[model samples]
Target: MTEEIEAQSFEEEDVEFFEFKQFNKNALSVQLDTDTVYPEVIPPYPSLLAISNTYGYFVAATNEGFIYASTQDLHELFDNSEAGSKELLSQKIHFEISEGKVRCLRLSSDQLTLIVVVEGGLVLFYDVTKFASEKAGCQPFQIMTFPDDIRDLRPNPGEKYNLIAILLVSGIVYIKDYLLNNEISKIEGSKVGERFTAMCWSQKGKQIICGNHLGQLMQYTPEGTHKSSIQPPQELQQHYVQNVLWLESALFVVAYFPVIQEDDSELDVFIISRETKSKTLYIKSPTICSQISSDHPKLPYLYMETIKDWGPNLKCLIICASANSADINLIARDESNNWTSLNLSDTTRAALPLSEVNDEDTLPVGLALDFTCMESWITRLTADENTEVPPVPILYILNNECDIVAYRCFHKDAFFVDESFSGMSPPQKLPVTGHSSGMTLPKRDLSHSTTSTQNTTVLSAPIKTESPITDPIETGSPIVAPIKTASPVFAPIKTASPVVAPIKTASPVVAPIKTASPIIAPIKTASPMIVPTKSGISNNSLSSSISYDKNISSQKKIRTPPPDSTPSRNLGSNQPTEADSKTPHMIRMNATNNEINELHNLIEELENSYIAKYHDRTTEQCFDNPDAWLIGDLPVITSEINRLEHEASSMSQALADLRRQVNEFSHDVHIDYVKTTKDIEHLMYTPSTITVGRRGILQSRIKERLETTFKVGCYINFQRLFVYTNLYLCL
Candidate 1:
C-alpha cells in the first residue's frame, strides 16, 4: 500500500513538472490593427515578421506589399497601458514594394541592415538606422535580383565581413558580401535528386550546415568547399529534414515523415555530436500540419537560449514553432543531459477557445524569440527576493488573424513567493538619495520681502530726524536685513520712538520716491551705513540676510513699469478681451481657408488634366474613322468575345475526338481478351474428355487438336500438352 502511494505521488510530481514547463498563453495577447495607428493600409494577412535583438521592436509585412517597422518597444504590449499600446501600434517606417509581395525579412545581428525578399527573385537591402531616424523615404540602398525566389537569408555571425548566405527556392545557396556587392561562392545541391530545405550558419560563421529533403545534413565551408555530411538513422530514413541548428557541440536536425493523415505525422529531432559525427539523442513529437502546399514547404522555427552553467553537455531549452499549430513545444535537457519535451496545445486551447464565433483564427504565421525582454520581465515578476527564477525565452507568435500572443513557457509559481514566508519579514525600504525624496522646506515670500524693503528705503530717505529709527526695526524682524539711515548725522543715536510720528506723517515722502529716481538714489549710496548692529542673529540668519539684501538690490536695478501702463498690464493679467481672443481664431480661420483653396486648385488641375487627356485619346482614335466615335470601341469588345468563343469551341471538339479514340481502343482490347480466354479453356477441356483407354489414339487426337488450335505463334504449347494427355490416358 505504501509503495502504491509513493508511485501515485511520483506521478503527480511529473504532472506538476510538465505544467510548469508549458507555455502560459493567457499571460499576454494583442491584436494588431493598421487602421488604428498608421495611415497606410496593411491587410489582415501579414506574410512576414522580423524582430530585432536589442530592443523588442519588430517589422511586419502584409500580403498587399506594405511593410511597417515599429518605433516603440513591443514589450509594452504586456502592460496593456493605453498610451504604450497606442505607441506600440504606431509605426515609424513604411515601405511599399512595387515588385511583388514581401516573402522574407531578415534583420542583421547588429541591427544595421534590413534584408527584404520580394517575389520575382528580388532582394532589397535597406539602411534601417537611416529610415528609422528620418521617418520618410522608402528606398533601399542596394538591390540584388536573382534568377529564382529566395527562400531565406542568414547573416554571418562573425564580425569579419558583412557576408550573408542566401538560400534560393531551387535549392541553391550563395555566399555573398552584401556591402561589396560581390558573390563569393555558390553551393549547389547534388545531381541525384537532393535539395536543401533548411540551412544555418555556424557559431563563428566558419561553416554552413544545410538539411535536405533526403534526411541528410551537409556541411560546407564559407568558401563553398564540402566538409562532411551526416545521414539520418534507420528509423528516420526517407524523412524530410525541416530545420537544422548548430549550437556549440551538438547539431539539432528537425525532420518529419510524410503521411496521408497530417495530424498523424510525427516530428522527429535528432541531436548529433559535431566532434564525433554520431547521433546522441532522438525525440518524437506529435504536431498539427499546416494546409500549405508541398511545392513551397516552410521549415519550422527553432530558437535556443545561450547556454550558461547548466551542464557540461547541451543544457539550454529549445523552442520550436512549425507554423502548423497555434501551440509550440519546449524541448529541454536536465542536469543529466536527458532530453524531454512538453506540448502546450491544451493550455492554448483553454486560453483561446476555437469555438467562439469571432475567435476562429489560423495557426501562427511567424514566431519571434526575444530573450532580452523576457529576462527583464522575469526580473520584475520575481523581484520578491527570489533567486530561483527560471530563464525562459519570450516568444511572440503572430497569427493570420492579426493577433500576437506572447508565451513565457513557464508557470508563475516559479517567480511567486509562498504566503507563509511572505509574512515572516517586512519589506525592506530603499534608501532615499535624491533631494526630491526628503522633507521639503517652505518657500520664502520674496515678493512680500521686496515690497517691505522698498517701503523702508523710501521712508528713511526723506526723514531728517537726529534720533536713529529703531521703532520700525521691531516690525521688520521678519525681514532678514536691517535698514540704513540716509545721512551720517543720525548714525550715532539709538533712540527707538523719536521718529515714529514723522514716519507715520511722512506720506508725502512716498510720492517722490515713487515718481523720481533721484530722491531714492540715497538708498543705494548709503550702503556703508547699512551695517548690522545686532549680535543675536545666527550665522544662517546672517547669510540669509545677505542673500535677501542682494535680492532687494537686484530688484531695484530692474526697470519698473510706469503707472500709465498699469491698465494694460491689468488687462493682460485678467481675462482676455473680445478682440484679443478673436486674434487666434481669425488666424486659424485664415489658415484653414488657405488650405481649402490649395486643395480646390489641386483638384481642379487634376480634373482638367484628366479631361484633356481623355479628349485627346478619343479624338486620336476617331481620326481614322468617323464610325469608331459613334460605336465607342464596341467592335473591339466584340472581337475579344468572339475569339474566346472560338477557342472554347476548338477545345470542346478536341476533347470529343480524344474521347472517341479512347473508346475505340478499349473495344479492341476487350475483343482480344475474350479470344485468348476461349483458346486456353478449349485446351484444358479437350484433354479432360479423353478416356483412360486408347492412349495412342488419345495422344494422336490431342496432338492434332493442339497443332490446329495452337500454331507457331499460338498461346498454348502443343508438344507439352500432347505428352501430358498421353501420360494421363496410360495411367
Candidate 2:
C-alpha cells in the first residue's frame, strides 16, 4: 500500500524522510570490512509482559535475531505527542543481538519479567528494567537452553506464577519457574505419545489439556497422568495443533496444516467435555479457524471473542488484534475447552502480520494470539484494567458479525475484578554491548521500498485488527556483529568455527570462553532520541530527540484533511448535510466533535461504504470512483495477491539463494583452501622429489617427463593418458 500510494501521489507527495546515524565524536563506526557484507536485521514488533504497573518491560523476539519492547504507557508507542517522519520507540534488545529468532514469548502477570524462547531452542530470562532504566541498559539475568527448537511456553493459570510449561521438540514439557530456583520437570503423555504444541490448565486447575503435532487434543492431571483423547475432525486429525485453551468446564482446541490447497487446510476449533466427552465443532472453514477467549472472567453478558487463520495464504496469518479489523474473528472458550458463545457477530477482533507470500525464502517470523483466542498460536489473554466490567468475555470473533458459532469463558465471572494489578511500562533501551559481526542473520533492507502497490490493500479486513496486516519488518541478513563477550554469558562450547555456514544451522554454542562483563561506554543519562534508519535527518544522539517535550510540537507537522459531514449523533441532533454523502477527501478536522464522526471512523466507514455502494457496479464505474476499490473471492483475489506477493517474496528468496550460494562458494573455497594447505604440507613433509624452478620451460619439460597423476572424479577420456587413472583429483 505504501508503494502504491507513493505511485498514486508520485507527483503530489513531498516524499519526506528523517534518519539517525553515527556522526558524533563517538561516531557509529563499523568494522569497515568492505569485503564482508553486513548482516541485515529487520526488527519485529514484539509483545512484552512484565509486573503490570511496575518498573519493567519484556521485549519479544522475532523469527530473526532482534527483540522488541513497547512502551509501558500505550500513549508513547502509538499515540506519541505528535507524528514525525520516523517513529521511534524506547524499547530495544535488552543486551543487543537476539539469541536467535524468538519462537515464543510470555510475560508473567507480575509484568516484572518475561521468558524469551529463541529459534533452535534457546531460552533467556530478560530483566526489562535494566535496559529501560535511565541508568542501566536492559540485561540478561539468566540463560537456559535446550537442544532442538522450542515449540511454546506458558505459565500455569492455576498456579500463581509458581510453574510454567515449556514445550520442546524432544516431545517433553518442562515445568519450571523463571527464577530457575527449582529443578525442571518433564511432562509427557502416558497412553498416546508425541510432542505437544499447545497446553491449557483446566478450570478447576487440577487438570491440564494439551495438543500435539498431530491433532490429538487431550486432557491430563496436573501430575502428568494421561486421560482420554479428544477426537478432532477426521480430515484435520493429522494437522499440527497450534494452541489449546480451557474455558470453565470445557476444553477447546484448534489445529491446522501447512498446505492450504485442500478443504482440510483451514484451522479447526473443537469443544469437548472433560467428563462427558460431548463435543462440537465451532468452525470448519477451509481457510478460517475459530478462536476462543474471554474478558468476561470477571463479568457477565460481556464476552471476549477471537479467531485464527492465514490472512492471504500460508505466508501471512490473521491473529486477533487489540484494535479490530475485517480480516479475522475472535470467539470465547470455557475451562472444559468447549467454545460457548451466543453469537459470533458480537465478537471483538485483532490482526497480526504474516509472511509476504508462501515461499521458501528463509525469513524468521511468528505470532501468538491472546489466550482467550490462542487457537492457531500461543498467547495468554488478560483484560485491560481500564475497562470497568470485570472478566467481560472479549469475544474476538473471526467472521464480520456474520455466521457466529461457539463461545464460553475460561475462568468465570468470579475471576474478574481482580483489583490488584500493575500497568505495563513503555519499551526499554539497552545498548547492544555484545553485538559482533560474526553470525549471518537474514534481514530486509530498511533503506529501500519498491514503487509498486499492486495488491497491497486488498486484504480481507477482519473485525479485529492484529498488528499491521503486513510483515512490516523485513527479516534481514544475519547480524554479524563482532561479539563483545557480553557478561552473564553462558559457558561457550568449543568454537565450531563455522566460517561461513547457514547461521540458522550453525551450532548454538560455537565459542568456548569464560564469562566476561561488557565494557560499558558512557551511559547516556537521557533517553536516546528516535533515529531514522535511512536518509540522514535525525541526530543519532541521546540528548536530541527523546527528551520530554515542554510544548506540543512533533505531531503538529502531519497534515490532516477536514471532515466531510457532521455525523448524526443522538436524538434531536441536526439533520444530515448534502455535502456529507458526496465529499471527496473527508478528514476528521474536529477531533472533539461527536456530530461529525462516523461510528466506525472514516477508514471503516469508507471501506464499508465502498464495498456496499460500488461492489455491485461495473468494474469501469467502480474504477472511476476512487472511493471504491477492487475485491474478489478468496481464491481469485488471493491468486492475484499471490502474484504480487511472489514478486516481493522472490526478492527475499533471491537473498536466501544468494546466502546459500555464498555458503556454497565459501565451502568450495574452504575445500580448495584445505587442499592447498595439504599440498603444501605434503611438499614440506615429503618434499616433492621433482622441484620446479621459477622459469617454466625446464619445469614443464621435467613435469611432462614425470608420470602424470590421476585426477579423481574427472573423466579423462584422454586416450594418451595411460599413466593417469583418476580425474579431477583433490591432488
The global C-alpha lDDT for each of the candidates, from Candidate 1 onward, is 0.48, 0.35
TM-score of every model versus the real structure: 0.47, 0.38
For model 1 the local lDDT of residue 406 reads: 62
**For candidate 2, lDDT tens digit of each residue in 1-731?**
11111000001111111011111112111111111211223122222222222333323332333344432332233323232212333444433334454445665544445566655555555544444443334444444445455666766655455456666755667665445223234577554446676676664456677877666776776556667666555554356565565655653535444322343223444433344335343433222322222221110001112332212111111222221112333333233332322222222222222212332111112222222211111112446333222211111121111111112222212323342111112323433332211312212111111110010111121111111111111111111112222121111111222111111111111121121212122222233212111111111110111222337442232221233434243212233244643444222312212322233266466668766764456444444454554443333345557998999999999999999987885575456444434444443454345344422333343233222222322223223332221221212
Off by over 4 Å in 2: 1-58, 62-73, 81-86, 90-94, 129-138, 178-181, 191-193, 203-206, 234-237, 258-264, 273-326, 332-731
- Prediction 1 global C-alpha lDDT: 0.48
**Model 2: residue 53 alpha-carbon error in angstroms:** 6.8
Choose the strongest candidate by TM-score.
1
Worst 10 residues of 2 by lDDT: 3-12
| Total colliding residue pairs, candidate 2 | 144
RMSD versus native structure for model 1: 36.0
lDDT of 1 by residue, 269-373 (tens): 555544443423344433323233333233344323332232233256565555444445555555665555544445332122131224443455566665543
Clash count, candidate 1: 0
Candidate 2, lDDT over the whole model: 0.35
